[model samples]
Target: MVITVVYGVLAVICLGYFAGIVIYTQTVGFALFWLLTGLLLCAAGAYCAYRRKHPDRLEMPLMLKSAVFTCVSVGFLILAAAGITIFMDTEEEAPEDLDYLIVLGSKTVGREPSDTLKLRLDAALEYLQENKKTRVILSGGKGSGEDWTEAQVMYLYLKNAGVQTHRMVMETQSTDTEENVIYSLNLVKKTDTVGIVTNDFHLCRAQALARKQGKTEVYGIPAKSNWFLLPNQTVRECFALLIEKFMGNI
Candidate 1:
């Protein structure tokens, strides 16, 4: 009965989180994770309720139970370790006087920067102001429904904010983070001290990708993320890290 109640409460919490995300952002993204987890929790809750009524009936064999337990334990450990890797670099900052700074792009609101992209641009702007010699590569391609490529939007924002055109270059062909690093690196040497500017939760994976691409002096210039969205973004990043590892990109 207690176990059933626990699962029931957890299901409601997860489902509530899913609903809140849907209402707030309108984009599913990683919030689908909450939806699926909520449904699974609901099913688990139902099973717990059924088990409570059945008592001794439908008992599992000890060997199979042990196998399931082991798998679950191992999976939990892997996820925990991945989460730690992401969190540890959330507050990372790049050293000054980098040879190049790659500003990874996020979504755009028409021709303007979205909040996520704005944060990244703002962080990069601050760094550029301090490190005048650090050239920037604004990296992102156009996506569906976007009025302009993300790199173009970033370029406009930074240019209007007083960053000189000569100090920035646009890599408007690369669509994702891996490509962001790849195509941007083509504009400069791999031996250059490059700093990747992105949201705080994304720095770890971004830096890993840079290293995987043979960049020996890569650094992270983390931007702040919305506190309310951090949990969802962090989980999505954890899965992304795993995927990148599986694909041998990091």
Candidate 2:
């Protein structure tokens, strides 16, 4: 009965997390939801293994094994669900008509943009080239170390890539994803309809965050990433989605 109640509580938490992800559509919320779910499953599995090993405590070895398998199976299923979501979310489709292109930030080592950030910038640049009339907003702030802010680095990169300075705006005060949209919104005029650009695994959350910040017409432009790193990134996103849901940030 104790084990059953514990499992029930864990199941409830997992269900809440799942609902939060689908409803809030926040990456951090999904992340946190899965994080908690994973931890619970792992804990349950360990407890069952312990009970199985202690034959004097529990008379039914078969029951303990079944419980362990169930816990592990549920955990694996949750991870698989998150993986499938990431894969399905990866494709980038250009919006029909966009007034603004919002390029999200990534890490910088000194003055150079990280590979992830570069991919996002490349995708955004491609979008700009295809739609020459849209204004670009390079959004991100500086972290510890290094030279220029993410926004400045992106601006310089875009400038060097032949985009005109007049066509670009910069929002350099945002330190995180939530702040990225919040701060960027200040730079947007009332007439602008924004499309956010980020990596494929990142788009769902970014779009959700943008919508939360009142950018109703936001679209996602996702950049590509290698397959091996995809799993870790998806897992990270799931945790992030959960946190955002809890905080009501998205």
TM-score of each: 0.92, 0.70
**Whole-model lDDT per candidate:** 0.89, 0.77
Pairs in clash, predicted candidate 1: none
- What is candidate 1's CA lDDT for residue 167? 96
The TM-score measured for candidate 1 stands at: 0.92
The whole-model C-alpha lDDT of candidate 2 against the native structure comes to 0.77
Quote the lDDT for 180 in model 2. 87
The sequence of per-residue lDDT tens digits that candidate 2 reaches over residues 30-58 is: 34545576567656656666665774784
Q: What lDDT is reached at residue 103 by model 2?
A: 89
Error of 2 at 195 (Å): 0.7
